[model samples]
Target chain A: MKSQRVAVLILAGLFLYLSLYTWNLRTGHLDALSNHTGLEVSSWVLRPGKWVADRATTLWKRYVFLVGLQRENERLKDEIGRLVLENADLHERDRTVNRLERLLSFDPPVHWTRKGGRVVAQRLGPAAALETVLVDQGDLSGIRPDTPVITPDGVVGRVMRVGLTASTVLLLTDPNSAIPVISQTTRTPGVAFGRGPGRDMVVEYMNVNAGLKAGEELVTSGLAGIFPKGLPVAVISSVERSDLSLFLSVHATPLIDAALLEEVLFLARTRAGEGH
Target chain B: MLGPSWWLLYTFVGVWAQHFFPGMDFLAPGLLVSLQEERRGNIIWLTVSWILLQEGMGSLFFGSTLLWYGCLILAFHLGRGLFSSTSVTLMCLLGAFLGALHFLFTLMIMRLEVMAFPFERVLFEAVLQAALTPILWWVAHQLYPRRLRSDERSV
Candidate 1:
């Protein structure tokens, strides 16, 4: 009887396995269901925990991590004082330039509508080869998948997945990430692909004779509709020619330090009919 | 007796822990509870819940957890005569072995190329999960309510 029961259980298990396998392939309803419920439950559970962590982190930063903060504040104050004076001089220069522009009738550059949100979670393990960070804003805040996520420093990444209350931003350093970029100095265009996490991105398909030099800035080529043109992407760190491959082996470092990103700006595209 | 609220709290904590600490097998408590109860209904419910939680949190293709739990149940039944079902050591060994097997099986089922997969990192996590399962099981054993303890002993 025991042997018969075991055989029955094995058969049942096999049946369930095959069913799930077929179901998984046919309709991705499982993923949609899991994603919705998982995000909801996880968000609810993490709310209180995040509050506690935030308080503890604030306390530590204010009391324990404040030793060097004072010196840093003083240095920043002096730098700000100098910048104010320089800004006044630049203001006069900008006025003269504006007059010249008006006389020449130059059109103003297009402006992007942007929203700000905080990073809530990160997918940082072996399961995800594509490095992604979850932000607290979603469709409710006009955050759409493929929206450019950036910071003051430079381009961070583009939104990949959007939930109801949260969304995942695929970092530029992810293996699957590719961006069309151009060398600021050489004006030569190439596709920058993420090698992996914490590794220098490679700019592939560039001609070996492009004479791309190290220290050249790489910016969005505007060819890809995802990112705005001229947004800083990476700085060329090395350029080499492979004997076997036809493409040049160019490496560049991402401008943004993804590890330290706490908050990001979402550049939401405005509809054509919408007023600026 | 542990009521439904207690079980809900336990599941909530288990899900939360699994989300934050990916490699840790929080499902060990459910496994222990099912084994101790020795009830077919209990086992089925626990297995279903575990599969749902794992599939929800896991970023991989769906059905990974189905395959994992299927293998785990098979292993339990096949080894029932080799060791007592209540043996914690056996549970730990099985947990470790199954953790590694699950990773390998999922990779294969997903059709992930070997060159692209992070083998070392996944292997390290699997091993860590194995080592940590016994500790979690011990914690679950200690925290089980008195009524459940009596019921388990009576069984």
Candidate 2:
């Protein structure tokens, strides 16, 4: 009994030391080690479960979910047709603006190398750490690292890491993540930063007098050219004065569900000449 | 068959289950603690499997689950004398409290790296834990009836 007690005490000490060490670990050592091990071992083990989950999702999509989606699609098609006819006049105006921009010496940003993919699975919460989506596109689809991903609505994030068959999106909401942004109405510029633990998008370092208002829409300021400029980032949710600094404390909710997005566009735009 | 140690065994099982399906939020570990009074061989096996699973998951820190489970089990083993498992209701409450304890501990440890502390997230997790712990405790109790009786044979 005495020896057992002593052994338990020793074990306890070792664990405490280990926990303390890991608890304070800021580097990526642990994550890397896990990945190396998990890659080699758990993939085979988890294959069955992943397969089942994938099949279930696929079956649901093809059967029970598709009929309603088809009906919804048809309805939307009708609505779209009606709207397109109604908006013919607006399209003419848009053409005029495009012509005027060309005539007035403005260069419109172009979309190039647009690759499409379906989101296969969402990485488990903090489970994936970086807001990453496992898309079914890879080298075959020409998806590459640093590709800007977007939805029909707005910018999602960028492709950070890619596997042969899958790629991980480094979400704009990751703490280490940032996007160049500008106010659509006034061209006020700032950097959009992720509020970690999945909070709203926030922009920082704008001058206190920058005239930011609640509900003002923020777009990807083309200043960086990394993003094709003018992608909607978020709307100003809150703006307040800081006690210690001249910069205002500002918050904006992201336009896209970084976690729930299932389809995205990968812009294979090279980081050629863009810094914001 | 393992008798009184079944809860401990299932806790280990929870860890193993995490290998297949990610995101139980240490529910397996917490359930293991409430399942029995102490750790045992099966419990150790369960923990190891989970550590391997989490390691394999490619997204978590190496040995994160091992460090967490090992530390908590050691602590709980020493501290078990302070709590009574007189009944299943009490056992569940104990289990839930422990589950909550683990969540708080993790948050404290991870807060430094945390840039955004969304309150909704914390609240959601807490509520999920509270709701799930008793269910897990009940299931564990069923698996190891002796833990509920508290007078069964050791093995």
Candidate 3:
């Protein structure tokens, strides 16, 4: 009799909780409950764990893992020394090449101020939300919305939202993302828009008559005023023309895999009027 | 006297585990507490505290943890008829099931909220969480052997 009474009371409580939760969900007021207190409390709780983990990692690296790492570090140091010597040789060669280019009156590439930032957080929303990543740089770091983010390989994304100490980057694979691009081979202009994460972006607004081929390189057109001109964006994967449509359907894979990126360079374009 | 200390320790471990391994259900300790305590008030308090912790740590909806605990409680009650409450294997299996259920439930809620679901990544996380829960339960049992024992004891 007592057990049955307890069961009934638990059920009643469950029903009441569900009703309130559903009401909050519909009204979108549930987010109001997700204040900074929860974040702070969670951070405090996790800090000790993180500290323990760090200590464990340090102990492992210093005591257990040092033998192999020492050899690898020595090898890496030798390789770096060799690379430094090679870099000096290359610098001299570059100076000669630049002198020849100046004599030939060739135009140099556009220069932009670059800042490096670390990826602090990723996919800050629910499962079905936009593909976004947060960096450790913000307004204090001169990071603003629409600033083009890149890696050594190619274009990564652009800053979408800025906070005090962090900024959110909208990856190129996000559905809402669109960038002006040009094919290197055919010199055809088009707009590349993301299909979704893990999918190739579709290049639209290209003339049906435009001769585009597979394996052609795609670069930023600088028409959008966000990404600088001639930055490598993607390599053209395929191109198709439909009899029913006026625009050619082209697909290109992004050069940067945003999921694998740990660090990125933010390109803040200096206006012509501003002295560098 | 020791109850609050145990709660604090478990809560700290749960939050830490969740930080290192996202999508892992750190609330398994709370479930063990609820089952062991059996009192309605104790269960309610444990569930509420866990819900708050999960909501604060997770980037999901506000009541997601509440809904998850509700489902877990129902499952525990249903499983009580089939398996002994003291069985470690039963607890492990329940943890695995709850892990998968958590992924599916969160996915459904995200769909309702009109969010884009990354199916492959979420599924992978669900599988990982399911696999890890049993191991985590084993660790929890080792740490709180007396509390997790099936023998009747006063609070």
Candidate 4:
């Protein structure tokens, strides 16, 4: 009888898993969960925790070490002051918002729309470098499938799976992560892929002879429609085309720290009924 | 059935160790223990959480981890009667087996993307798990002396 009960339990678990797997594969559970109710609750839950935790960390690092904190703040404030007049802050925020508002308002990019959700979690490394995270919202939150996640900084990743109250984010740093990127400076474009060993992203398909240089900004070209036009993705950190390979694998550093992400915004609803 | 307290101990230790060590994850061990305790129903959650934790540290999904660990637990638990109750050899074997299991599973999960990928995280995790499991088992045995001797030891 005991063994029978155990067998029944295992069978139930197996049933649950198989059903979910089948159900998700067809409907894109990740998208559903991200836009679901979970997304809504997380938006509210993570904020308070983040606010408290950020305050605590800032207080401890700044207040506990008052003199050093003040010095660092003074330096940062000086830097902000210089960039403030140049509209640096506005340029950063408006780019993400405006890009979404434009393409969605213009045409349904591939008959798809976008949903925006607050990033509720940031996950980091421990082993073979997964570089993924959990977002607090899912299908019920209007989070959809294949939605590109971004921040004022740049592209973070896309929604992978959405649970009832949570969703998994595949970070741009994982080996599975890939994005199309173009150089704003030289107009040279390539495909960006993450290698597990580092924080850098490798760009493939560029002309091996293109005058590629470091520190160039890379942005989404709006060709894929997965991302809105002209969202900053990364800065070119390297250039490499081995004699053995024809594709020049230029590496770039993602502007957003996927590991340190506290919140991610899901661009769900577009102005044209598809949010960028 | 494993006590809730024991589980809480297993779960929280992973968090505490991960918090302090900065570059360590003991979730595989917890998963192994869960499987060993016959909590097979919870294995999915275990594996999912383990995968999340593993990837959270920045790894690619290498398949066959659950298969390999399942085989190890099945082999170990089934072959338990051959070993003595308090034999050091038994402890050593357990440690060695666990270490090998952990290392192999780690490598499989880490390199799930590329075929025949070139890296040896398996050997690294095997050594770490083998070293750690025995010490942890020994400590648990000391803490719950009678439970260690009860019918649970039959496995």
Ranking by TM-score: 1, 4, 3, 2
* Alpha-carbon deviation at A266 in model 4, angstroms: 2.1
lDDT of 2 by residue, A1-276 (tens): 977986998788777756745653666455444444433343333345567876777565445434544566687856765565447647756975664443334223464446666665554322333445556665557776677887656778887655445555767876656898888776678888887535787788767878888999888876655677777888889999877897888898888876566567777653553322
Candidate 1: clashing pairs of residues: none
Q: Give the per-residue lDDT digits (tens) of candidate 1, residues A217-238.
A: 9998878788777888999999
Rate residue A112 of model 1 by lDDT. Answer: 62
Q: In candidate 2, which residue ranges exceed 4 Å CA deviation? A: A1-29, A36-117, A120-148, A158-170, A173-177, A194-200, A211-217, A221-231, A237-245, A248-251, A266-276, B1-42, B52-64, B79-94, B140-155
Calculate candidate 3's fnat. 0.21
- Top model by DockQ, which number? 3
Question: For residues B21-65, could you state the per-residue lDDT of candidate 3 as single tens digits?
Answer: 545676664576456554677677777766665564455457766
In order, candidate lDDTs are 0.69, 0.59, 0.69, 0.57
Model 4 error, position A207 (Å): 1.2
- Residue A75 displacement (Å), model 2: 26
Any idea how many clashes model 4 has?
Answer: 53
lDDT of 1 at A163: 58
* lDDT tens readout by residue for model 3, A24-63: 7687455444423343455445445546876787565445
User: What interface-residue Cα RMSD does candidate 1 give after superposition?
Assistant: 3.6
Q: What fnat does each of the candidate structures reach?
A: 0.19, 0.32, 0.21, 0.24
Give DockQ for candidates 1 onward, in order.
Answer: 0.25, 0.23, 0.28, 0.18
lDDT of 1: 0.69
List TM-score per model, in order: 0.75, 0.59, 0.60, 0.61
